[model samples]
Target: MNLALTVLNITAPVFLLAAVGFAWVKLGFEYRVEFVTRMAMTLSVPCLIFVALMRIEAEPEALAALSLAALSAYGIVMIACFALVKVMRLDVQTFLAPLIFGNTGNLGLPLALFAFGEVGLGYAVVVFAVMAMLSFTIGIWIVAGRGSLKRVIQEPLVAATLLGGVFLWQGWQTPEFLTNTIDLIGQMAIPLMLITLGVAVARLETKAMALAGFLSLIKVVICVGAAWLAATFFGLEPVAAAVLIVQVATPVAVTSYLLAEKYGADAQPVAGLVVASTLLSVIALPLILAFVI
Candidate 1:
């Protein structure tokens, strides 16, 4: 009973905030998602990452281990997803990236913060940073047939991760006033991201939901299994392992739909993925949290 309540307590606010956005859109309110996403990714999320990484006191060895584990997990997932796509004869351009990259940023971060507090956030950010870097690079390549290394370098979130890592490594702290300001900016990230996720889902149009649902279930199983194996293989600490699993098991990101639309790779199927996977997460994430937490 206590465990169930704890899981609910941790997840309620995150989904409730998203529900607010979903309801707002249903009421015919205007939400410029592109603007919100740009601001969050460019400013607020960067601030959040920089602050979290800068302030985290976890052992450097632990952080390094988690980083490598995350990388290896994603690599393994990529290989597994590739084989699945081949067997199903799905489009490499449309199906592969969405399957390989989950919604580690908007959903994963807040869930981690609520489920495991600041320590979880610390580990979650590392995974988010890794996903962001890869999504911008290889994920993009899969969709567009060419990777944009320049775009990856120009991304504010990438810059923040690199800079925050340096600060953490050197044991440096920003001036008190500056830190406070950055902290304030960082505080906007979670709520904004959650709401934006809801808004994105509410706006998307999907077809082939049956196929999407089947794939989504497979994705959850594969992602969670791969993450667990990677965590155990790498000997990750308990918190790190739990955070890694949650991050990897998140739903297909709404960004996948946008990329498919932009690259002419069949946006409808991608939209189906985004919608189906997200709806599945409503049931899937909480159940995963029940075990992981």
Candidate 2:
């Protein structure tokens, strides 16, 4: 009973903030997703990642273990998702990327923060960074048949991740004033991301929900299984293991829909995936948290 409430305490704010965005959109309020996303990605989120990585309280060895565990989990998930897509006779370009990459950024970051606090966020950032690199490189390649290394290099968040890792490795700290300013900027990341997630979902229009639902369930199972196996194999600490599972098992990101649209794949089905998987997450994340916690 206490555990249930604990899970609720952790997840409520996440969904509630998202709900605010959902309701705001439904009430005919104006929200410019493009501008908000650009600001968050370029400014707020990178700041958050840099600060989190720089100031993470976890041991270097533990952090390193989680990083490798996350990478292995994602690699295994890619293979599993590939086989599943082929077996289902799905459009590989449209379906494979969505299945492989989950919503590790907007959803995973906040959940890790709430469930396990700053240290969890630190671990989560590592996983998020891994996902970002893979998504831009291999994920884009899967959907577009030719990913651009130049495009990935242009992402500000990627630079932030690399710099942050360097800082963490060297036991470096920014000046107090600079750190405070960056911390202030970083503070916007979670709320903005959650709200943007809701807004994005509200705007998506789905098709083939039945297929979406089935695939969504399959994704959760595969992600949890793979992450758990990887964490155990790599002997990640408890918090690191939990964070990896949650991050990897997050639902299909709304970005998947945008990618499909851009690459000339069928966007409607991907939209269905985004919606179905997200709705599934409201229940799925908490249950997983309960077990992990």
Q: On residues 1-293, what C-alpha lDDT tens digit does candidate 1 reach at each position?
A: 99989999988998899999999999999999989999999999999999999999888899999999999999999999999999999999999999999999889999999998888998999999988889989999999999988988999988999999999999999999999999999999999999999999898889999999999999999999999999999999989999999999999999999999998899999999999998899899999999887
| Cα RMSDs, all models | 0.8, 0.8
Specify the poorest-scoring 10-residue window by lDDT in model 2. Answer: 58-67
Cα RMSD of predicted structure 1: 0.8
How close to the true structure is residue 176 of candidate 2, measured as C-alpha lDDT?
100
lDDT per residue (tens digit) for residues 1-293 in model 2: 99999999999999999999999999999999999999999999999999999999888888888889989999999999999998999999999999999999899999999999989999999999989989999998998999878978999889999999899989999999999999999999999999999999999988899999999999999999999999999999899999999999999999999999998988999999999999999999999999999
Candidate 1's C-alpha runs over 4 A off are: none
How far in Å is the alpha carbon of 37 misplaced in model 2? 0.2
Cα lDDT of all candidates, in order?
0.93, 0.95
